[model samples]
Target: MIKIADITNIEERKAIENIIRNYREDSGTVISLLQDIQGHYNYLPAYILQLLSRELKIPLSKIYSVATFYAQFSFNEKGKHIITVCDGTACHVKGGPLLYDYLINQLGIHGGETTPDKIFSIEIVRCLGCCAISPVMIVDDELYGNLNMQKISKILSKIRKEEMIQEGSK
Candidate 1:
């Protein structure tokens, strides 16, 4: 476990301190502070949270409660790409489950799991407000609807090719 005192990244510590200072006066800014921290680190680092608790003089329990209560806040690191499958009533009736299974099988990851390479993370959401486009899967911000196995394969292939090209360029 990383302790607050052991946070050696001077710039990161400064950034956290700055965030705390910026929101210190506003008692209701806890959520916004946490959101900024999460945006910086992708997930809340335990050491940073400890630092925040000390700097802001807020109880760790309260901070933790707020973090866990919000579905958007995540403790675990996420993959570079987030794939959300809609499992709403409309989507489910239109073969959302099948698409989810196909994704799991193809990616070799269960729901709520990131691929080993960190290329993709699979998640299921209740709704995406696109009932007309039921059975939808969103990769990053791009949405795919009316999908079949072949369309899924093509999409995956295209993404993989793009990634490979990007990696090669890098």
Candidate 2:
């Protein structure tokens, strides 16, 4: 077994330890603890979940269920850029599927798969509630609307360039 001494981040370790201590006896608090961990790390790592489960004596299945059920929680390692395509009725009627396919084909990965370089993760959402902007996509929270095939290509190119620039700066 790996020793806790390997955990170097004192604050982070304390935060997690505190959560576990405060909610040790509360089974329902597992979800909240997971959320707090997610706030620290963009996505929940399986090992961390297992650690919490062991500490709290919660079943792994129950932890997995909550993670899968919540839309806010992500099991996949997220990319620097998150691409969300809206496919609600309004968006769907306006060729959302076509746009989604274009993105997947171009990225060479389906929704939830991060690129090999971990620069992007494609996501499909039922709606953004912006029916007016049917066939829309959001890149890192910036919404683009009224998309056509050509427009999508351009937008993707722009995203790639932006990612490249960010990487170069770092």
Candidate 3:
């Protein structure tokens, strides 16, 4: 329901124009252009995609296909904090499922869901490339290994407190 004019400011429109101009009808540059757009906005806003389609003279469906095909691209807005739980073979063997379940219970959101307040989002990834520290979960860039329910509780509490303090400061 968001309009292009509502979601895009003058500065963002100029940036998008620059990105399209730089690549200009080079279909090979589609991925790179989308990446740049995603960098500007946390996710690919529908309006931006529509604008990109018109600017590049590419089919909107084609652009959408590319966006949806990639796991790295997100269509919906992400939360302020992203929490990823490793569900790879090594992590699962090391009780990754248990950790995931614990998080779901604590946050009241399953993997791939964001909290109602938009404070946190959880994802279950195959691996975080740190199997050495199996059963690992990451909050934003910080990693926690050898996790248990107790550890998860403490981590969530700490993050909540930090969010509260940040809100108070604002």
Worst 10 residues of 1 by lDDT: 1-10
Task: Give the winner by lDDT: 2 or 3.
Answer: 3
- What order do you get sorting by TM-score, best first? 1, 3, 2
RMSD of each: 2.9, 3.8, 3.4
Q: Best candidate, TM-score-wise?
A: 1
- Model 2 local distance difference test score: 0.82
Clashing pairs in 1: none
lDDT tens per residue, model 1, 34-110: 89998787778777787778767789998999999999998877777788888899999998888888988999998
Better of 2 and 3 by TM-score: 3
Instruction: List TM-scores for all candidates, in order.
Output: 0.79, 0.71, 0.76
Query: Which runs in model 1 stand beyond 4 Å of their true positions?
Result: 1-5, 8-18, 24-28, 165-170
Clash tally, candidates in order: 0, 0, 0
Write down the TM-score for model 1: 0.79
Error of 2 at 81 (Å): 2.0
